[model samples]
Target chain A: MTVQEFYEEVGGDYNEIMTRLRTEERIRKFAGMFTRDESYKALVQCINDGNAEDAFRAAHTMKGMCQNMAFTRLYQSSHEITEVLRGKDLESAKQMLDVVTTDYNLVIAGIEKLLA
Target chain B: METMEKDTILIADDAELNREMIKFIFEEQYNIIEAEDGEQAINAIMENSDKICLMFLDLLMPKKSGLDVLRFMNDADYIDYIPVIMITGEATDETDEKAYEYGASDIIYKPFAPNVVMRRAKNIMELFEHRIYLERKLEKRTRQLRESREKLERNNEFLINALSSVVEFRSLESGEHIQRVKYFTQLFLKYIMKMYPQYGITNEQAILIVNASALHDIGKIAIPDSILLKPGRLTAEEFEEMKKHTIYGCELLEKFKQEDNEFYHYCYDICRHHHERHDGNGYPDQLKGDEIPIWAQIVSVVDVYDALVSKRVYKDPFAVEEAARMIMEGECGIFSPEMIDCFKLAKQELFAVTEGKFSFADVMVK
Candidate 1:
């Protein structure tokens, strides 16, 4: 899968990511790094442990990465959950978590395919 | 490990991807140094402070926050020279204000465009460079001004020396006689300035009077050699010719006058009136009592004192005690009573300075 095909599968913005990161080679290189980033795993574990503070930080970190990668769908969902978690509204944040999880997994799986 | 010709830029973030991204953006133009957390960032700054030109700090980090690093930079006094641009994904107004208060150079939001980031960093570097350049230029200008002022003062002293010694060189008298007259004049003026504030002479005014005392005998330059160099007592007619030297000194000053109004006034008064006795019997205009300017009176007393105590070709030098007695007793030429008091007050300083190594003190103030 090409970088554009990978972005299409994950519902990310290929043109916007290229504008920031510059070229297809850069996009591919960073996508491989993103696949190994454990912010998604940390977020899941912190939410399960009811650690709203750590969960907020994890979601915030992931939100940054998604924005840098132009994973638009995941960036939007994580950003919302980050706001709810920042407010310490864990119940609402937990409900919003489902949408972020779906987008995060989609991006991760797309990266795996593109890298392979 | 090769030495880099490019300036170094430090990129510090908790996220490896963020550091990598910034490095990629700037590595072509700068030597990139990466830090994984605030602690590492601080250490990197410590190791490469002389090399680092700019820092891109992530506001949130694990070991120490961006705010902590800024505080360290400010405390270390590195904030003024090294510009820091805080890059944050969660750039709230509070954090932004805190970052600036701690002296971050600028703050930019996350996912920044590479071109905008590069331009802003370059602009900040240029501003710091220009400031350093201006500071150096100002220091050099101050040094140059001080040097020129010193040179001007030296030139003034040289010209004063040449003008004052003309008569000494012509009269077959050694330069030491004029120098002793100037020293004794300064000593008397300093004491009078302290004992008698009613005379209202400032230290600057005293120095002017003292410098002009050197020219009191300049008029001797004009007397006919037959009378000026006469080895024995002068006839009344020849004595009359000798007295006109005072008038000749004033004529010479008028022909060579320059822009310094105050200095000319001091030199002119001392030259013409130094011989005027307090009892209305001395020479030229013979202005009696306080009619003589105090500075001229000062020169008059010191001239008598130096002439009395210094050995001349025809006479042996009198003792200091005898010279003091002669001036006060109205024997060597009458002087103002106030000046008689200043003369007694300066007895010790007069001895020390004339006997050669001791310096005059400026301890007196009104």
Candidate 2:
């Protein structure tokens, strides 16, 4: 599948990401790099470990990655959780983590299929 | 002294993805340096401070924060030279203000656009480059100004020596006489300045006085050979003509008088009044008791001291001790009592100069 098709399938913004990366091959390469990014896993582990600060940092980092990739679906959820954790609302962060997880999984799966 | 040919951009962030994104944006133009955490960022800055001209600092890191890096740069004064662009996923007003206060060049919010960040970086680098270029230009101009001033001073010195030598040659005296009088005037002027602050003679004024003393006999250039080069005692008529040398010197300086030139005043005063005495007996103007400028008084005594201690066609050289005693005792020429004290203070140095034991250049260099 094309990178545009993958962004569409994962509910990301193809035009926004293309505005930065320019070429399809460059977009594919950078999009594929997101598969190995551990900010999602880091966020999950920090939330489980009751570490609000590290969890906020991880969520914030993941939000940046999502925005850069134009993964708007995941970026929105990660942004919410990052703000909640920033406000020391670990309980609210845990609840929002579910939505971020669903969005992150969809983007990761699309990147894998696109790269493959 | 560090070279400015650094073509490296340092990407300091804990997130590998962020570092990669930034590297890709600038890879075509710059070599990328990756620092995974804040500690590594500071270490990278320390190791390659000379090689890295720009930095993309992530706000949040494991070991340290972006603010910490800025603080380090501020403490080391590297912030003035290196442009730091802060990149962050989330920045509040307070955090952004704090980053700027810590010397961040610009703040690029996370998911920063390639075009915008590139534009910001280029503009800042251009400003710093222009500032450095202007600074170097100013330094070069300052050096050129100083060199030309020194050259002008050397030319003035050469001109004075040439003019003084002409007068000495015309008077049938050796060339060293003018230089010796100038040296004696310098020594006596300095001693008088130390022993008598009432004169309020600044160092600049003293230097002008010494230079002007060389032209004290400049008037004698107009005197005819019958009066100036007379081998025996001058007749009353020829002695009157010889005394007109002082007035003739002032007339010669008037031909070359320069408006706004402070050096001219000292030259004119010394040439016209070097023969005047404190007791109102010396010519060509007998107005006495401080009527003669203090600088002329200094040149007057030094001129006599030099003449007595040096052999002439008219008389043999007197001993330095005898010359000093004669001046102090008011036997050779009338002088102020305070001037006699200054002469006593300078007797040792004067003797050294007369005996060729010390050169003025050595004293000046020290």
Candidate 3:
């Protein structure tokens, strides 16, 4: 459950981020945040409350965090939900929320495995 | 390692984790300020405009959007002064165009690669610092140019005054004679400026007229010792030679004429035409009425008044009252009726100035 294993588990582009940051220590610190991040929970709550604007904001934020942390699968699913909610396509966004939640769960589990 | 203070960078986002991540990335290089919402971001930018050099703005936050902050910055003209980079998780073409239109320096998508964020932020900060350096340099250069111009103007005044004093020394007249003439011309020109708005005299022209008045008798430098120093009245031929001083003065000043040198033109007019009579009967050009240059007309009245009140080798000085009468009576030479009127009106002040009863510096200070 090292940084390399986490990158491999989530299929994240570790090398790409490391090229600029140039330090595994910094990347490790960034990856460690995923364990405590609540962006996905906020997104789910907004979707449940039928607040498409706040839901879009939450999804968008999670998408960015996933991208930066190289959580490619979760980033893609969150990106899809963000676009739908941003366009105010509430029904489509509501449907896509399930897909986002599934990817979010996979990312969380992968990070937990790497940390353990 | 160095003792210098770090530049401030403001990170504004609704998410605490996002703020912390960004702060961790930049804290080593910059002094970081955190704002949890767009409103706090704006407040930080307003309060620390001088200190904060760069800003990372979250596109969407509770209460106020990043675009709202940008709108306020644009309204206050703070956007150009402080560079802003928009951070958005869901960037679209519409939002991108609007952010740029509102003066966003750049846009960075959320979940940006750490390396990409670092490079982009560093490049933008460097670019803004370079721009500020250029602006300060430009301001300093402009100030230096203004100071040099002022120095040149002072030098020009000093050289002209020195040359005018040399002319006074050669004419056997007291240096104060030229000083009185200059002051009298300034006083008369002031009255002309107020009473005759149609003349269109500017302050610059009035100052040039005063400066040039010091050289009104410069032609006497070319006059012969016998006629110039003669105690007795000049015969007809000698008188004719004496009158050529106006033409000689014009020739002396005409040598300095060059393109766009308005001061030289003033000197030429005052020296050449100051003796010309308003009634078309005076020596040299005999320029009558308005045909005479206004500067010369002003100098002519002051010169005659100064000459009459100051003792010359040829005759004793007359009283200011008697000189004013002779001018009005057309005994010395006919003048512009307006000149005569201004002369009479300014007589007491003129005498006070000439006789040392009042300082010309007081009139100048006013």
Question: lDDT tens digits, residues B102-182, model 1?
Answer: 988899887788899888999988887677668778888999999998798667755776888888888778776767777
Using TM-score as the measure, name the better of candidate 1 and candidate 3. Answer: 3
Q: TM per model?
A: 0.68, 0.77, 0.76
What local lDDT score does residue B237 receive in model 1, on the 0 to 100 scale? 96
Model 1 CA lDDT for position B174:
72
Tens-place lDDT per residue, model 1, A1-116, is 88999998999988898888778988889988888788889888988899988888788888888878888889999999989888988889878888988898898888889988
Query: How much TM-score does chain B earn in each model?
Result: 0.70, 0.83, 0.82
Query: Which residue pairs show backbone clashes in model 3?
Result: A64-B110, A64-B111
Docking class of 3: acceptable
User: TM-score winner among the candidates?
Assistant: 2
Q: Score the docking of each candidate (DockQ).
A: 0.53, 0.52, 0.36
DockQ-best of 2 and 3: 2
Instruction: List ranges where model 1 is wrong by over 4 Å.
Output: A5-11, A32-67, A73-114, B1-6, B35-50, B58-81, B88-106, B134-138, B141-145, B177-217, B226-250, B259-309, B313-349, B357-366
- Residue-wise lDDT of candidate 3 within B1-366, one digit each (tens)? 111333899999887667776787788888889998888988998888877878988887878899999999989988876889888765579999999999998998765656677888888877877787788888889999999988987777667667878767766666777777888888898888988879999998888888888888888889898888888789999999989988898887767666488888888888888889988988797778888998999889888888888887778989888999999898987898889888877888887876778877655432
Estimate, for each residue in B1-366, the C-alpha lDDT of model 2 and write its tens digit: 534687889999887778888888889998889998889999999999888878999898888988988999999988987889998776689999999999898999877778888889889877776776787888889999999988987778778878989978877676888787888898888888898899899998887788888889899889998778878788899999989989999999999998678799999989999999999999888968778888899899988998899987778989999999999999998998877888898889889988889876555421
Interface RMSD, all candidates in order, equals 1.1, 1.2, 2.7
